[model samples]
Target: MYGQGMDAAPNPWFSWDYVERNWDEVSDRLVIHTTLTLQAVLIALAIAFPLAVLARRIPRLAGPITGVSGVLYTIPSFALFGLLAPFTGIGRTTVLIGLVAYALLVLVRNILVGLQGVDRDVIDAARGVGYSPCECSSPSSLPNALPSIIAGLRIATVSTVALVTVGVVVGYGGLGQLMFRGLQSDYRAQIMTATLLCLALALLLDLVLALAGRWATPWLRGRAS
Candidate 1:
C-alpha cells in the first residue's frame, strides 16, 4: 500500500484532462486576477498622477517618493504578502495591497517620467499666456506628457498581468490556486498548462496594450507609442 501510494503521483504538466476538468476553476481564477490587476493599476495611477504633478512643481518631493516606491518594487510578492498578513489578514484584501505596492513604482515613475518629458517651451508658453498651474498642468502639459505616461502604463500593464499570476501564492482567487494544486500533488502536466496559459495571457495583454498605445499616441509610433 505504501509503495502504491508512493507510485500514485500527479502529473499536472501533461494532463489535458486536468485542465479540461477544471476549466471553470481556471476561468474563475483568471477573472479574479484580471479584476485584481486592473483595480490595483487604477488605484496606483490615481495615487501616482497627483504625486507626479506635485513632484514636477515641488522637485523636493520627487526623490523621497521615488525612493519609497522603488523600495516597494524590490520587495518580493510572497514576503510582502506574508508581512501584510498580520495587519491586513489573508485573502483578497491582502493580495490587492501587495499588488498595489508592487505596481507603485511602475505607475509613479511613469507618471513622473511623462510629466518630466513635457516640452519646456510649451510649459513656458502656458505660463506666459497667464495659464494657471492647473490649466497649464492639465490640457497643456498633459498633451505633451501623454505619450510618456502611456508608455509607462504599457509597462505597468505587463507588470500587472505578471503580478496577478503571482497573487495565486496567496491562495485565494487566482491561477495560483491551480498552480499550487499541481505543485502540491506533483502534477507536472497541470503545472505546465497553467504556466503556459499565464504566459500566453501576459503576452496577449502586452500586444493589445502596444496596439492601443500606438493608436492613442501617434508620437509614440516612433518611440513612445
Candidate 2:
C-alpha cells in the first residue's frame, strides 16, 4: 500500500497535467504580469525622456541628475518596496515606484548619450534651414537617437520583468505570486512553470521591441543594405 501510494503521487519536477489543469489561472496571471511590466516601463520612459532632454539642454545639471537616479537604482528593490509600504501600502503602487526607480538611471543615461551623439553638422543644417527649436530637436535629433533609445527600452523592460517577480513579497507580484505559492507548497511544477513563463515573456518582449525599433528606423536598414 505504501509503495502504491508513493507511485500515485504527482511528479514534482515537471507536469503537463498540472499545466493542463490550470491553464486558465496561468493565463490570467500572465496577463497581469505583462500589464504590470508594461505599465512600469512606460511610466519610466515618460519620466526619463523629458529629464534626459532637459539634461541635454542644461549640461551643468546633467551629472547631478544622473547621479541621483543612479543612487536610486542602487538601492535594493526589496528595500525600496519595504520603505514605500508605509506610505503607499503593500500593492501594485509600491512595486511600480520601485520598478520605475530602477529603470530611470538606465533610460536617462541612454537617452542623453543618444541625444549627445547627434551630429553637430546635422543640428546646424536643421537650424540653417529655418527649423524651429521643436523641429530641430524632435525631427532632427530624435530620429537619430531612436536606436539608442530603443536599446534602453529593451534593457529597462527586461530588467523590470525580472524585478516584478520580487514584488511577490508584497502580494502584487503577478507571476511571482505563483512562484511564492509553489515554494510554500513545495510544488515544483508551479515554480518551473512560472519561471519558464517569465523567461518566455521577457524574450518575446525583447524581440517585439527589437523589431519595432528596426521598423521605426528604416534608414538603418537602408544604410545596412
Provide the TM-score for each candidate, comma-separated. 0.85, 0.91
Q: Which residue runs does candidate 1 get wrong by more than 4 Å? A: 1-14, 127-131, 139-141, 220-225
Least lDDT summed over 10 consecutive residues: which range in candidate 2? 1-10
Best by TM-score: 2
Best by lDDT: 2
Candidate 2 residue-wise lDDT, 140-199, digit = tens: 455888888999999999999999999987889989988998887778898899999999
RMSD of each: 3.3, 2.8
Off by over 4 Å in 2: 1-8, 128-134, 139-141
Error of 1 at 26 (Å): 1.0
The collision pairs in model 2 are none
What is candidate 1's CA lDDT for residue 163?
A: 74
* Alpha-carbon local distance difference test for all models: 0.76, 0.88
Candidate 2 accuracy as lDDT: 0.88
Please, what are the lDDT tens digits per residue for candidate 1 over residues 1-225? 111366764433366786788788878877787788778878888887777788888899999989999999999887888788889877898888888888778878877887787878888888898987767776234677776677777778777777776666566647677677777766676677777777777788778777876676676566733
